[model samples]
Target: MKDVYLFSGFLGSGKTSMLTDVIRQLKEKNLKPAVMMNELGKLPFDSQVVEKDIPLKEMLEGCICCSGAEKTEAQIQSLLLDSNFDVLIIETTGAAHPVEALDAVYSPLFADQLNVKGIVTVVDTKLWLHRQTLTPQVRSLFMEQIRHAHLLLANKMDLLTEAEQGQAVYELQGLNPHAFILQTTNGRVPLNLLEDLKATAQVAKKEIIKAPLSAMQLGSCLVEFTGKEFTQEQFEEWVRTLPDTVYRMKGYVPIEGIKNPMLFQYAYGMVQWLPEYLKMPAKLVMIGENIDTVPVIGFN
Candidate 1:
């Protein structure tokens, strides 16, 4: 049977970094790994992180838990038939609910051929300490991700002070007493720790995800800034005025006087900019609750 590991975490919680390390470790042990990445927008930005030699399938413009349920099953089946891999790793979009994502994977079509290892969630330690600042719906989403994880990685420990880190761990342990919690920086964890993990008991009982996904109320929109270049200062100012509901935004953006577009990422109130050598589409995909209502002007 092929082992399946589901990586669940909030936006900017280091899921991709963890995935890269896991893939590298698995390769060292002579185990082939296949990846399935889900993104909330038309562009598959994160998929670029996966190397070309790895077998990768991407689902875009939707989350696997709801709109892409059927597609998720199809992709899994495709990977099983076409790839010679010992393990399959699924990286769900940040907005995905853990229960619904597992529900999508429990399809009977090829259930007998797969063994679900466990859900490994990456928690941003500093973000958890300040989760109360988020909207009630988003905060509930964040807690649900932690509450359902079988193995939790409290990531980004470097950003937290000793006192704050202790408080975060205490609360995370209280939320998930059954799971093993590891404090990590950059989502680093020992691979041996994952070898014996079994899917949570909650996964064995699948009734929880039967409710309609509309109840979650998350949304996303893709804004293409094709042919437009903005001054770096202008773009940053616009981002500053956005509402708290805007959880994450990422894409290649063209900046005035720059030879190539820059890779831009925004989560919570923090923004990161990386220089990109290759020219790509100048578009941004935003994900959050009621994100469609978030305004975009001047650079359409």
Candidate 2:
């Protein structure tokens, strides 16, 4: 599976700078990497920063979390099919929400082929300190981005005084106690820091003491079995073990010994498998709260 890393931060927070450095380091290690850049501007200004050889997809004029989400899915599928890269780096617009950006990446077909490394958020320490001056909605969005990060980079530290730097660390730690925070100038983060980081979309139970179910939003991911088939017994067993949070699943599955794919659906603990006269895309969309964590459909 290819590894995926998400770059998220507010405007002028140095996400592009961080992405450049990450690409450089990956090249140093001789690993191939691809990039998907989301820009709200008419043209993707950041695309110029990525080298020509790297497989690049640009999403312009919209945030990946909202208007651009459908496009994001198509672009990712294209990259997966056309490129031969070990890592995929997605840079979202400064205004994008981390959760929605991730939602866009978890398409059922792509989820199994990609290993989500985590969201790395860059913080402009100065702006963070003066965040109270911003409008409430923007401020909340920034907070949400930071809160969901597995790795946090407090960038542009050169502008902060020693005392202010200390305060930024303290307050950021308070906001996201689970993240591994690092202070850097110009977003120069060490690759070693990312060695073992993994993102579990599920929020920790202890952290839920104050904000319960905030991470359990209703979401969906499509599962495609175009080039694969599954045994009916194993497939049913997989469905039976799924959590109650999985409210519904519907798709076509190519069952062993069956001439064509079957139309399958599940809801409220009930399962339905109907015979289909023709072969359709062996894909199903699963919907529920926190469904992004659902394991990829297996074909053993």
TM-score of each: 0.67, 0.72
lDDT tens readout by residue for model 2, 103-178: 6676644555766667899999999999999999999999988987878999988999999999999999999877
Please give the lDDT score for candidate 1: 0.79
Q: How high is the lDDT of residue 24 in model 1?
A: 90
Q: Native-vs-model 2 lDDT?
A: 0.79
State how far residue 208 of model 1 sits from its true place (Å). Answer: 20
Query: Total clashes, candidate 2?
Result: 1
Question: Compared with the true structure, what per-residue lDDT tens digits does model 1 show for residues 58-169?
Answer: 9999889887977998999899889999999999999998766766665444554677677789999998999999999999999989987878999999998899989999
Question: 60, model 1: CA deviation in Å?
Answer: 0.5
> Residue 47's C-alpha lDDT in candidate 2?
92
